[model samples]
Structures are given as structure tokens and as C-alpha cells.
Target: MIVAEHLTKRFGQKQAVSDVSFTVAPGKVTGFLGPNGAGKSTTMRMIVGLDRPTSGSVSIDGRSYSSLRSPLTEVGVLLDAKAVHTGRSAVNHLRSMAATHGIRRSRVDEVIEITGLTSVARKRAGGFSLGMGQRLGIAAALLGDPHTLILDEPVNGLDPEGVMWVRRFVRHAASEGRAVLLSSHLMSEMALTADHLIILGRGRVLADAPLADIVEQWTTKSVRVRSPRAREIAEAAASDTVSVTSRGNGYLDINGATAAEIGELAAARSLPLHELTPTTGTLEDAYLKLTGDQVEYKTKEVR
Candidate 1:
């Protein structure tokens, strides 16, 4: 498990992260999400000892990252896919990383095939494409079979197949009781992959909870009603607590209520209803609403 308490970072006069605290538990995938300039990269950097925090502390398991005797075996990190030597072959690079941790060559070969790097094993790192480089980086991370994994944008340049493979791989790893933390800009993918979420805004944690809880708490549930007496329904339902709006001719949108309530309201008035569909909020909806006021750069509307 990874635990961070009162984590804060400052660069001269600017504060990048402030009193941020969160936990990435074992046997689960925790997704890190935030808008641009929300200090996600800085937080990840601090976790692996890349950037020293101005105050507070973070630990993997029970010790700091620098205190670990064998850091690679305890936690595998892929913060930058391009950190490898450009002149080295993919196979040689993995071998070199393995040499530091006393890992065997068979393990190196195993990760190569696991990450689908056999075709480019002998190819120089500089010649690999963006997707291939990502695969190679993943191979190095998996070389030691670490108990914890931290990947930033692992599927950034992957194709559909590669993306699916990564999704399944992370799920399988978490099932084996490893702590996994990843950050991505793809909400649709994150919704399908992550079991929990840690959302950041303005260098502070806005939410940290299960994916379902985040969606339920941050979004509004609504019912769509269609009938000849739509206007009548709207007039009856309109109040300080409930909201009703007419969508053109025969449709009424109802909020702050349930389908059963709307149906009972229509039945009491002897109104014939054609449709009554309830829509639950999704992860994307919750994210947009939660971070709506926290965006730093707002786009101007084109007239």
C-alpha cells in the first residue's frame, strides 16, 4: 500500500500541491485525475523521490522510496517512457536495469514477450515509435515483478489493442494484491478500468472515493417524461425543491425527483404518459461538474 499524509510542494513563491493526502490500497486500481496544471505530475514525481516535498511525507509500504534497499523490486515506476538510453537496444536496456537488481536473464526475456517487445527486442530505442517506446518502458518496469506500480499515461499513444492489453494487465496485477496507481486523460477508459479515484483541483484533493460513489454524489439524477400534458406536469412539479422544464412539444424534463414520483403525479391527474425514462449520471458527468469551477484556462465561445 502507498500512503501520503499532508503532502505539499512549493517552487519558490508558487505552491504546486497543498496538504494533499491519499492512499492507494492493495488489490485495487486507483486512478489519478485532474485538469491541466492541477499538479498531478508534481505529486507523482514526489512519490518516487524525483522531487523533494517542501513539507509532509509519503511512504510506500512502511518506508520512504529512498530508504528501500531494493527500490525496483518494491515499486516499479514508469513516469517517463523516454528516460531510457537512445542508443541501446530494448533487450540490452532491460538487461541493464535487471543487472542492478540481480534479476536473471530469463525474467528479462519473460517481460519482453509479455509486453509484446520480441519483434523490437534488438531494435535501438531511438528508432521505436511512441507506442513501441511505451511497450519497452513497460517491459523494464515489469522486469522485477514489483509489488507496486505507478504509471503515468501508460496508454497515451497506444492503439486499441494495446490499450485493451494494458487494461487487462493492470486488472490482473491488482488482483494479485499489488497496489497500482495510474493517471490518464481518458475518462471513458478510466471509468472502465479504475475501481477508485483521486481527483485533484488547484493543487488540493477535491475527492477521493470509490468510482460509483463519486458519480452518485457529484451528479444529479433525472427523469424524462413525454406526454400530451407535459406543460401541465411542468406546472405541477415546478417548486423551490423540484425543477421542471419543457422540451418543445410533448416532453418534460424533471429533476430532483424519481420516476415513481413523476408517474404518480401524472396518474393522479388522469394524464396519459407515453414515456418515462430515468437517467443516472456517469463518471464523465460527475468529473465535469466537480471540476467546473477549478479550470484555470477557460476557452472563449466562438460567435
Candidate 2:
């Protein structure tokens, strides 16, 4: 397990992270989410002792990462795929890292096969493509077979199959009772992979809860209706309390009202209804809603 209490960091005049506190527990995949400049990288760096915290503490299991005699065996991390020695072959690079903690050569071969890097194992890392670099990074992280894993943008340059492999790898790791803290920009993949979430914005913790709870809490309940008289039904249902959105094509979404309420309203108005179904927002919807005000960069138009 990983525990962070009152973790904070600052670079010169800019505050990167502020009084953040959360736990990445065993047997679960806790997703880390944030917009650019949200301080996620700094926090992960502090966890692995790469950067010093301005205040507060972070520990692996029950001890600080620096205090561990065998840090590799305790925790594995993949913060950057391009951090490896560019001139070294993939095999040589893994060998050097494995040698740090006396990991055997068989394990090196194992991880090479596991990450599907055997084809390019003897190739210079500098020559590897972005997707291949990501695979190499993952192989290094798993070399120790540590009890905990911390990965940042593990699927950034991966193909569809590579992405699926990561999803399966993290899910399988968590299933084996390993603590996994993952950060990614792919909301759809995160929704499918994470059991819990820790969302950060502007360098502070905005949300720490189960995936379902975060989605449910940030999103309002809404219902979908299909009918030729959708505009009419929506107009009839609209009031000071109810909200309606016309999607065109005889489809509309109604909020602040239940499906039964809308159905009854349509029936009373004598509007022929083709469909009336209750629906909830997806993870992406909930994330956008939760971080709408917290976005650091805004586009001129979504289109």
C-alpha cells in the first residue's frame, strides 16, 4: 500500500501541488487524473523519491521509499518511457536495471516475453518507436515483480493491442493484491480499468472516491426520450425546476425529472412516445462536469 499525507510541492514562485492527501491501497487500481500543470507528475516523482516534497510525507507499505533496503522489490514505477539509455539495446538496458537488485536473467527473459519485446530485444532503444519504447518501459517496471506499481501514461504511444495489454496487465496486477496507482489521459480506458479514482486539478486533490461514486456525485440524473413530439413533450415538461435538451431527430434529454414523470407528462399531453429510457452520464461525462471549472487550458471551440 502507498500512503500520502499532506503532500505538497513548489517550484520557485509556482505552487505545483498543495496539501494533497490520499492512499493507493492494495487489490485496487486507483486512477490519477488531472489537466495539464495539475501536479500529478510532481506527486509521482515524490513517491519514488525522485523529487523532495516541500512538506508532508509519502511512504510505501509502512516505510519511506528511501529507507527500503531493496526498493526495487518493494515498488515498481514507469514514470517516463523515454528515460532509458538511448544507445543501449533493450536487453542490455533491462539487464542493467535487473542487476541493481540481483534479479536473475531468467526473470529478464520472462519480462521481455511478457511485454512482447523479444522482437526488438537486441535493438538499440534509440531506434525503437514510441509504442515500442512504452513496452520497454513496462518491461523494466515489471523486472522486480514488486508488490506495488506506479505508472504514468503507460499507454501513451501504444497501439490498440498494446493498450489492451496494459489494461489486462494492470487489472491482473491488482487482482493479485498489488497496489497500483495509474495516471493517464485516456478517460475511456481509465473508466474500463480503474476501480477507484483520485482526481487532481490546479495542484490540489479535487476528488478521491470509488469510480461509481465519483461519476454519480458529479453527474445529474437524466432521462432520454424518443418521439415525434419531443419538442412538445420537452416544452410541456419544462418548468422552473425541470431542464430539457433537444437532440434533434426526435430525441431529447430531460433532467430534474424522472422517466415516469416525463412518461406521464407525455401521456397527459397526448404526445405519441416511441421510447423513454432513464440514463446516467458516462465517466467521461462526469469527468468533464467535475473538471469543467478546473481546466487549465481551454479551446476556442470543441469542433
Best by lDDT: 2
Model 1, 78-118: lDDT tens digits are 98899999999999999999999999999999999999999
Off by over 4 Å in 1: none
State residue 154's C-alpha deviation in candidate 2, in Å. 0.2
TM-score of 2: 0.94
Backbone clash total, candidate 2: 0
Q: What are the RMSDs of all candidates, in order?
A: 1.9, 1.7
Clashes (backbone N, CA, C under 3 Å), per candidate, total 0, 0
Q: After superposition, how far is residue 234 of candidate 2 from its true place, in Å?
A: 2.6
In model 2, the runs with Cα more than 4 Å from the true position are 267-271
